[model samples]
Target: MSARIHKLIVGLTLALPLSCGGSDSDGGGKTAELTPGEKLCKSLQDYVTQCGAATPCDTALVQDCSSIVDLLSEPFMNGVSECINRGEGSMTACLTAGFGALTPTNAHTGLAASFCSECAFGAPGCEGAFFSEDNPDTAILGKAILPFSDSLVSEVSTDCATGLGCAGSFLSCTQGVIAQRAIPESTVQCLVDNLTGQAPPPPAGQETCVVEGSGGAGGMGGTGGNAGSGNASGTGGNSGSGNAGGTGGNAGASGGG
Candidate 1:
């Protein structure tokens, strides 16, 4: 099971470069001028934005949002590139296109939609998930996310309906449940502080998402046992002896005979 999981991780990492956008675009070449939202969407092109509907985004482009490591990979950046390319200078359109590109399978549409809705509009005091009150691009992004929010949350998880709030950090919180991993509170706070368009916070310990461990059913080998020391009496003894000895006399055997 461990080997299979490792293989899956490796396969995802290796296969991403081919199907996802490559690392070359991560550098600040042309993307320097884009807004944070635009940049994020651009970075995550292959993931499906829509699910549940027949005309949903492409399944192949959908990403496994379970691991932050995988989420931040080049494929995500390539998604940014694709988003930017698809946007043609409109940041909201780019993000919308980026989000719209993915089409999660029927089984995952509920999960995917829940995540999208939360990431988009669930954060508190942040005007929806991705935009702050001061963000100038809200007019464009805000409108786009509204209807998308409806579509995004068309399907919901049980816990999702209850926790309609962000865990302080929009991206971290959404990715946490998506990955089924838990994000440390400290980590969530730190990520929220350094996120795009936000001022940097004071130095802090690195935060992380704890991936769940896998367990296997196994049986332990049994060990051999040692003989206990005991005394053994002789059945035969000297005939007519004082102690009722039989034809053969013998002392009681000891030391685990």
Candidate 2:
């Protein structure tokens, strides 16, 4: 939760399509060795079922649980996996309690807030110990984050404090976060340009909230696919998502794609 751990687990961070690639079988019917990303994806899916928070996003898209790959950070995943495996009941409950009914497309956003508590704030949580300083998710979220605004904090915190912001909707929480942006346009623009290996789209929010920049144009599709190709998934596709950035500020159930 380098970006906002407790707040994330405590209900501070996240938004994603969420998935890893389908398992590939070998020519002779032997299963090929699983890549690190695929292994983690399997583990997370298992955990989701184990916790009763299983989602059908990938299945709905026919990606077959391949969308939420790689996650935003390995460190983040490691920390979360460790914490969830620690036998804490609250963590398990947090998975379901933080958000309401989930859908395949918006599960990532909801899970982000649910994981905030132990993942970022608790002793056994991943909060400070993990979290990459600069990953696609953080880059996109960082651009939208606004720690300096008291009013924004108060407003977001009101619901987030309940460990359930956005009216018990993770998608709504993501949009709320985006609306509070303070990061510079140039900085976010740089993220799209270099990270996606493409020219950045128009900067989101002028100098305030962003559109996340790369969209489907890069990251998951273009250069970042180096490993993004059905792997652990960038920010789940492996980046914070130029697509989410595009909808981050919009008011609807569809923001934070």
Cα-based TM-score, every candidate: 0.22, 0.22
Q: Model 2, 1-257: lDDT tens per residue?
A: 48566566644223221211223223446768765346545544554444433223212211322432222233333333343344322222322221222121232333334345523333353222222244553333322222112344344444443452332343245344433464333433332232222333223332121111222233232222222223233232232345333322222222232
In angstroms, what RMSD does candidate 1 have relative to the true structure? 25.6
Predicted candidate 1 versus true structure: per-residue lDDT over 204-236, tens digit per residue: 321111111123223333322233336743333
Candidate 1's displacement at residue 52, Å, is 36
Summed backbone clashes in each candidate are: 23, 40
What's the lDDT for residue 219 in model 2? 27
